[model samples]
Target: MIDVYLLSGFLGSGKTSLLSHIIEQFKKEGTKPAVIMNELGKLPFDSRAVEADVPLKEMLEGCICCTGSEKMEAQLQMLLEGESFDVLLIETTGAAHPVEAMDAVYSPLFASKLNMKGIITVADCKRWLDRDKMTPQTRMLFLEQIRHAHLIVANKIDLLTDSEIATVTMQLQALNAKAPIIQTSNSKLPLNIMKKIEATFHEKEINETAIGKQLFLSSRLHTFQEPVNQEDFECWLKELPDTVYRMKGYVPLVGHKNPLLFQYAYGMVQWLPEMIKMPPQIVIIGDQVDRIDVLGRISND
Candidate 1:
């Protein structure tokens, strides 16, 4: 399976810069890379960073997550049918939500053909520190982008004062307790970022087995055999830990004839009405979650 990496960050947070660096590194290691870049404008700019030799597919006019899932799936199919590459990189628009972008990539049609490496979020240190100046929606988006990352690149540290750096680092750590953060300037990264990330994951795997902790970025699927009380489910959601980054599936709520499509990210929960019958299961993604305990609580409810 081809390894897939999703690049996420707010506008001017150095996502394109990081994408360029990653592609260059892959080229040095004799690995061919393909890119699927999303832009929220009519014209594409980040597409220039992708080299001519690298197979490229651009999604312009909207964020991939906001765009129809069918479009995203079709683009992936086209790339797979036409290109040969060791790795695929998706650069999302600044306005995109990391969890939603991931949902788009998890299309069942191409799921078996790819191995999800993880989301690598590039955050501008100064921008992160001043995120409150942004509109409420934008600020929430910024936080969510950082919160759901598998690996974070705290970029543009050159512009931040020493004290500001500490403040931002502390906040980033608080938001994402497990993802490794690499401080950089100009979106520059260490030559072994991938190796370091892999090593970190391996260590987490060992720790998981030794201490009975959930694996970092691990996912669990739970299928409900019967409909659950809506009030009970909402209460359970409120009690979920912040480590539960994302969850999505169909849920059969009491009093409803059909299961509702549910999506949760960060602290927000969305339940969309579904007309057709769907599987009653949820895919929970998080770090160090107590799977047995979590399932038990929901099952008892």
Candidate 2:
């Protein structure tokens, strides 16, 4: 049976960074790691972070929970049939509810071929400190992500002051007393820390109170026709409502030949230069987003 680990975390909480670390560790140990990356839009951005040689499958256009269970079963079957790997990692979308994601993976058709290693959740330390700013639904989503993990990674601690880090640690411990919490910058997990997660005999634990499909979130995709002035684009970002949780993709900026990878989460934004040309498009995800209005604004300028 292939070992299966479900990587769960809130939007922009360093799930992808942890994924890279896990892949590297498995490679060093001579174990092949296969990945199933889920995205809420037609164009996938995070999957690009995975190496080219690893076996990977992308589930786009919906959350694993929102997408039909049969769809997940089919993807698992395809991977099982086509790949030769020791471990499989399923990276759920940021908007996904943990209970719903867990339910999707426990399909009876493929359950026996897989060993359900516990959930590994990455929590953003600064996000937890400022979670009060999030919508009620989003706050609950963040809580649920931590509640169900077997291993909790408190990421981005470097940004927090000593007092803030202490507060965040206490809060996470209160929320999840059962899981081991590790603090790290950039979601770096030591090889031994993974062993602590692996040593956990994870049985399928589904919290009945989990807010499954009730969390209403939506995503919109917009492609840019012309390079955008950085100053003007950032000014528009201020106009977006706080309900807009995540926005990530490649953007063609003035004076740059290649598109820069842009990510925005909870009032924070980042841009990374890209060496090769990429499609200039962005996917915006949020709770009850004004898609019509937001899309119109994005399409213009």
Candidate 3:
């Protein structure tokens, strides 16, 4: 049976970073792995950043736990039949609830063909602590992502002091007393930990009420024709409306020769230089955001 690992976490929790590391290790061991990236936005960002040689299938425009499950299953079927891989990794969107994602895995079609090695949940130390500041639905979604994991990876520990680290460890323990907690910065962890055999599914522990609630969230994608002034765009990103939860895409800057990749989560914003030439486009995921207003603001000179 193929070993399948489900990597679940909140937005910006370093899931992709961790996945890259896992893929590199697999390469060293002469094992080929397949990746299934579940993205909440229509335009892919995290998948593009991942450096892997294996075949990658993207489930975009919706979370795999809900509307995208059928597509995900079809992709998995194709991978299993057409390719030879030692392991399969499913990287879920930050907003995905573990219970629902697992349900897709336990479906009749896939349950017999693959063995779930473990459910690894990556938790951003800072964001996990401040989750209460978000809306009720988002806060619950964050908690539910951790509740069912066999391993809870408390990432971004480098950002915390020793005292802060201890406090965060205690908080994670309170939230998930059963799962083993591993702390790391930049989502780094020992390869042996992932290879260890562990119990994969916990159907009895799933909270049925939380399974279908995330579908209420809204998402919109917008494209811009002109390059934006770097300073002006940064200022606007900093003051984005509270309704916007996650924003990411590629943008061309006024003076820079190459376009830049941008990602914004809550109050944090990051811009990285890119070599590829792609049209200026962005995907915004939030609740009740006005599409026309967002387009006007982004298109402003």
Which candidate has the top score in lDDT? 2
Give a tens-digit lDDT track for model 2, residues 129-209: 888988777888888889888899999999989999999899899988988899999899886776656524344454332
Residue pairs clashing, model 1: none
lDDT of 1 at 244: 63
**Sorted by lDDT, highest first, which candidate order results?**
2, 3, 1
lDDT of model 1 at residue 212? 17
- Residue 28 lDDT, candidate 3, scale 0-100: 88
lDDT of 1 by residue, 198-221 (tens): 312332211111011211334466
| Whole-model Cα lDDT of every candidate shown, in order | 0.74, 0.83, 0.78
Clashes of 3: 0
In model 2, pairs of residues that clash are none
State residue 277's C-alpha deviation in candidate 3, in Å.
1.2
Give me the displacement of residue 215 in model 2, in angstroms.
1.8
Cα deviation in Å at residue 228, candidate 1? 63
